[model samples]
Target: MSKVEDFEELRPLLFSIAYRILGSVSEAEDAVQETWLRFDGSATRPTSTKAYLSAAVTRISIDVLRSARVRRESYVGPWFPEPLLADPYEDPARSAELADSLSMAALLLLERLSPLERAVFVLREVFDFGFDDVAVAVGRSEAACRQLLVRARRHMAAGRPRFEADRQERQRLATRFLDALRNGDVGSLQSLLAADVQLVGDGGGKSPQLAKAVSGAENVARLLGTVFPWLVRIGVTFEPQEVNGQPGAIFRHRDGKILQVLVLDVLDGRIQTIRGVINPEKLDHLGPVADAWAADREVKQARREWG
Candidate 1:
């Protein structure tokens, strides 16, 4: 294949690496576009197109991440990676790993790692780039890259899931969990939430949301009873949909305005974290959800349709 064709074929991988490292869709897109510009204006064909493009994107992402971290530190309320629709990759295994890394919980954990470590981890773990390529991508020695990998792995492992839950079971639980909350069934919500469950909202101060993270199952449960009912009263409707590859609910105002997105992290068959992103800026990337989100469809039925 021609170099152009090769780069096109590998563009998805480049963007995935950049997005995992930066965790912002717009920055990732800009970095990819810049990478393409550099590739397109090259004076000579590189021996390996993948290596060249990957390095360019990773380095650009690292630059973007350095600034992103600072912005997030002062960000209002909670912060979340932009919710992505199913990523564009065609392979099943890669797509699955991408989903895991793109998850809000995983991204939050990643925030603790240094930018270099994040780049190394994304290239090596998420994209399965070889150490030699990772070294080139991050501008580190193979040995140094391995050390960064170890540190990144250790930091992320500290927050690893306690146990894997069945996907279908998790989805069923999410739907049921939302149902209980909507009906003001705090008792049922308490039963499904983990003891240390935490609920966080990212409203960016542009909308009304919890100012701080609320913890404890009882606290979150009581919170749902108070809040969900208010949303219902205000004509806000909820729909079950996949947010960042996890089962979550999106709230829309009666007029079809997107309100908030709730993404739950389940562990051992219970909800461990309730992540809500109401920041209109973050939801902009997910774009409009169509009129059906405002449709008065049953949550379970909607899950089947949107899932």
Candidate 2:
């Protein structure tokens, strides 16, 4: 493949790495765009496009992250990563690996690290890049990279287990949750939620959101019961999709407008947290879901008609 083609092929991985590091979709995308621009302007082709882009993005993200810290500190309320939906990959195993890279709680913990530490940890732990490669990516010596990884590991000691659910299991759980929501069955929905479940919504003030995180299983249950009934009344269609590597659902209106993207963080057998991103800015990358889900609706209708 040509350099451009190779870079295009690596875009998803690059975006994944940046998104995990930065949390904000816009910033991560900017980091990637800057990396591409630098690559395009380079005088000589690098021997390894992936390595070069990774390094470029990591370096750029470090710079962006520093600036982001100031903004985050000054922000109005708690900051949250933009939630995502997990769409299936052709290779289920590969999909599982990718999903691990997008977990919300995992990403939140990463914010505690320095930018370089975040890059090193993500490269070594998440991407499985060798210490030497990570060193080069972050402009550190191999020994320093190792030390950074150790520190980063300490920082993530309280993280959830890095277990990836099988495709069938994820799909089954997602379907159950969606059905419960459609039917306004709060009891069934509550059963699927973890006891310490957290519901975080990001409208970026563009759409409605809780002023603070609605935490605890009971509170989340109350909110869901109140909201789901209205959501169903509005004629929203829910589709199972992958977000941040876990089973998630997307809600769309009857007119095909994308309403929100729901990402779940499941622990053991129940969902430990829920992230709802209704921000139009964040939804832009998912493209026009209106037609996409409309087509899906049509297919389902045909099946029912035939049946």
- Candidate number of the best TM-score: 1
TM values, all candidates: 0.88, 0.82
* Alpha-carbon runs more than 4 Å astray in model 1: 1-4, 93-96, 288-307
* lDDT by residue for model 1 (19-67), tens: 7888778888899999999998989999988889999999999999998
Over 36-122, each residue of candidate 2 has an lDDT whose tens digit, in order, gives 999999999998898999989888888889998987786544566776554222335455445665677677888889888899988
Q: List the residue pairs that clash in candidate 1.
A: none
Q: What are the root-mean-square deviations of the candidates from the true structure over C-alphas?
A: 6.2, 6.9
Question: How far is 236's C-alpha from truth in model 2 (Å)?
Answer: 2.8
lDDT against the true structure, each candidate: 0.81, 0.75
Top-scoring candidate (lDDT): 1
**Where's the lowest-lDDT run of ten residues in candidate 1?**
290-299
- Supply the global lDDT for candidate 2: 0.75
